[model samples]
Target: MFLRRIPSTIFGIITRSRLSRTIMSESPAKRLKTSPRKIGTHNGHFHADEALAVYILRLLPEYQDASLLRSRDPAALEECDIIVDVSGVYDGTKHFDHHQRTFAETFSAEYKTKLSSAGLIYKHFAPALISLRLNQPVSHPSVELLYQKVYKEFIEALDANDNGINAYPADVAPAFNTGGITLPSMVGALNPNWNTPVDQAGEDALFLQASKLMGETFARKLDYYISAWLPARDFVVDAINKRFEHDKDGRILVFASSIPWKDHLFTLEKELGITEEGNKPLYVLYSEGSKPGWRIQCVPVSKDSFESRKPLPDVWRGVRDDALSEVSGIPGGVFVHASGFIGGNKTFDGALEMAKKALVM
Candidate 1:
């Protein structure tokens, strides 16, 4: 998060500067009369955080066509409309520098990872940006959800990478060289290599290239969250709320249609008090429009775990159609996976019965 306090004197100064920029940006005529919105960051050896921070700022209406100012000169930076990932001061108004010794901000109290310039910019501007993308009020539930989720999934990683925060514990080592290619690595690759002649204009061009890449990737993730991910929550919540209709034990969830549901299932479980064994959903039944059957899937122990809370009966494993129906004494059976993670039936009732029989058998 950005520093909460802004000294009154400094606030007055920043407010006027920001106000002037806003006024200048309101019309093309005025912007031509004055200077365009100028985004400032230190030149040379750019990192993913600042690239992403600059990109995030450009998403705002005020800075959509903002000019980039790559410089280390304080006088030059002072002339810009806003500063990011540079300048020693972090009043959360004019300056958004995180390199200062006093800087120790996180996304929220719940988070302990120190924020980079990316996180700082996102913390301040993401809600309104999300609102713009979603066409809703800043206070809207979907907008808030998208804001938090996008930060966690996208922005936080850039912050963590820039701040040198390890994703895993020091004691833990990955089985493989996991970081094959990533945003930080990609951004770092864009920098001038050793012995490469550093042309100022060329460097600026490459920096904008990196910034655009970061911005487009971020926007794509946000777009997915808005169009696909957010809608799944409604489906999952509807299923969760209607679980009792699926079974008296409240251990089965039935969806009218298939959805991207695993994440929502886990989150909504904790949120809606699906913690107890008796009420916890163990199976999810959903229809496939392409196939004439309803698939019943065993819920994983957790979102990341491969283990199911209760897999389908072992006898039904790899069995198909009439054979499975005969073995399980449940008609209209489709094949159960060899792993016993999932099965299908010709009808929803048959699927429910299979789940019920699996529960007891």
Candidate 2:
């Protein structure tokens, strides 16, 4: 099993006035009034969602001078010169019984609606862009590259079963197969000597064992995927540098769909040395069970938590402010998540318009 710990100094500041000058010299906007752009990225397959966000940002300049300005509040729209919806899904309406409504029927739909209602422009880019940008065949290896390190370790444990009495041969080991077992049967399999009156007990035991083994195998596969896709992280880092031009005061927020995606970003941060004074990045707020290195504040949404919070705009403002302060002296600061907001009546076309307005704001 391969084991390597990511460094704690990934978020360090690289200060050089010369580098900053070079960056600024390359952009025509050096003399223009560049408003603060708020980018909201959602995690989905192929990084297409993020790619869409980037695409929207690219379109902002064009839209700033286009004809899509009549349907929106020119004032509120100006608050953010650019709002990129990196969330990979779109918003749609569904009719249930006698009433009609625009709500997310899938993951993408939910995200689109949330951003739109919040008055942010949302874009839902086709998933194909991700494949095109990657320009890599989706071989078995690529599919397997999405796993996490812990998942790989779990598979190893099942493969080796080296814990003596509890060991199972790699050949017959349930972990070798991706299929899972049922909970009760797995328990029975581990303790076969005991007799149970239920005829289904034996089958249940087998299923339980299989489930445990399957979980381990899945984790291993995930780790492999992440290791393979590390290059994508470089692409994102470069994009940030090019778009923001080493704006140390700006905050970047990244939203991904799964743990693996978050882990990928975490790994990239380590590689790029984005740290705090050569120390680990500080996680001021986080959900329970989120790992330290992941740099994610996993907040599971529920009715109660949702009701207790301030409006989405206020929440976003707070997050943006905090991130900016944290990386006060650094060239750029980033916040990443798998999913940020729920979807509403917003469409990709609307998001493009929003992006355009953001640039001029």
Candidate 3:
């Protein structure tokens, strides 16, 4: 089960704000936060609020111009019709208090470094604003109405963009564009599987074409979800099971980038009886250096070690083979390389899936 960490205090603050009251009021403008000038302007700018903001924007047309803010810019709000803040949604305690001041400072510094790379200034900014009405109650009817309007507009835009001349016959001009002509070749390319007819091929062909262009985006997403995120906890549990099955005769190796993840694995091992089994001992290897132990090996991957192996993949396979042979004494163990955000999970899952399929072979 995935547990979500939320700060109750933040929710309490939002619930108690004056903005909440205004949102609950009956006035349409108060509920909608629509300025007279903004009502006529079809163009709207949206600020990226976090991962959730992307989801929200996906559902709203008026908020379609949304892009992640590289840095905190309070002044940027002046040019936008609405602003969204997503910072409050994260688990503050886990990220901040758990690590103490040093952890918090380090996290902030790293965040600033990313911002600087993107040419953004590191300044304090708030998320979830719909214009000047900062921290207003979000539950008001006006807010809801605005949300609906934005959503509707976004949907319409998507439909128009999807169905315009490129999607239809060259003779058919887009509803939004006046004098532009769509080429038959562009339309044909858009409707590659035209033999199936529009009504029948609509959804399937659209997805097929999109997959070709995006390089199996959906398949990769599925692979990551099943492989990486779902398995982290299970990996620990499985290692414990394997340890017990082997009666400490075999070693368990765990990999992770954070202490919390490491601790979680440790706890899981203990819970699963891997700790108490007299047969094998567990050793943890990390940046603090190596400790002598028995059945378990904890190795920390350090920046220096990573830097020392500069030629990377050309020599990585040989180095990995040597390490595995030394540790497991098992030759020809599978070598899996997973990279990118979901790479770890995808690789893990793909391996398992392939193994399952290979049973038939």
Candidate 4:
């Protein structure tokens, strides 16, 4: 059972080497030239921004096997290949900290919320990252579109959350209490509970756990937007472009079949310069597909709003079938929602008639 004692410094190196991966780049030349990259962030009490930032950096080819050195120690940080959230600097190249007084970078002039380490790195790396995932060139249309879409839909929220920006004005209260369901909240819960004991290795392990959670969610969102959301844009755009064919006033849009379009209607309208009060679409008509009829849906005032810009006629609301047709002067009227947000018609002409009348009403 006898064993010889080794120097503590030599033992430290032995353990660290095993803890960090040496995968490096797959190319033999790069593998020989590059050691595993070091990603630096603060130690003790991690938050979502730094955790997600570290995870995102590891997604890049250069940092796939990157070792994380979670420390606030200046010398250790300076030795890191890339530092985030701890160095108090903000250069798109290396340091990506948001704590500096001079740090006021938003994604661009169009956005007002300040960037976090996650947003800053995402802004700089998104196109390249997307290109890698999509197997397309960096200049491809999808990459450019997904770059902005991902930032707006996913990263902006994280940036806002990390920078302490409120999603709504304090004067108004939320309708329901969500408790701690948000990504930031979930990541925060992974931390060693304040009253619980902690160790260096234990903290790093939890940090990686938070990072993997963030990375998986991020990847899934990016994938959904690419696979499901983006493809519908062109169809919606075509429907909008051909609106005049359905109605002379260009207020009613007709789609041959139903598609995921509510958000695209609003987005494409603005992009196509349909800003005037008279020019905006009031109703969208599309076949009900599996069902026997067509739907005439009111365009909401905004994406999440319940209020419509112009709802179906109040008289026709809560009416159905023959009664709806007679009341609205549109035959084959299947039904009109009590809320006046949508209506169904037995034929395309019936839906068109309903839309036209509602536009003027």
Clashes per candidate, residues 3 or more apart or on different chains = 1, 55, 16, 0
lDDT, each prediction: 0.82, 0.28, 0.28, 0.81
Residue 23 shift from truth in candidate 3, angstroms: 16
**lDDT score of model 4?**
0.81
Error of 1 at 59 (Å): 1.2
Tens-digit lDDT track of model 2 for 163-260 = 11234454664646644353223433443344544333343333334323433333233334444445455554543344232223222223221222
The TM-score, computed over Cα atoms with residue i paired to residue i, of candidate 3 is 0.24
The C-alpha stretches of model 4 lying farther than 4 A from their native spots are 1-27, 173-176, 289-292, 321-334, 346-349
True lDDT of residue 258, candidate 1: 84
Could you arrange the candidates by TM-score from highest to lowest? 1, 4, 2, 3
TM-score of each: 0.86, 0.26, 0.24, 0.83
**TM-score of predicted model 1?**
0.86
The TM-score of predicted model 2 comes to 0.26
Query: Which prediction has more favorable lDDT, 3 or 4?
Result: 4
Number of the top-ranking candidate, with lDDT as the measure: 1
Candidate 3 regions off by >4 Å?
A: 1-79, 82-112, 116-227, 247-361
Top candidate on TM-score is 1
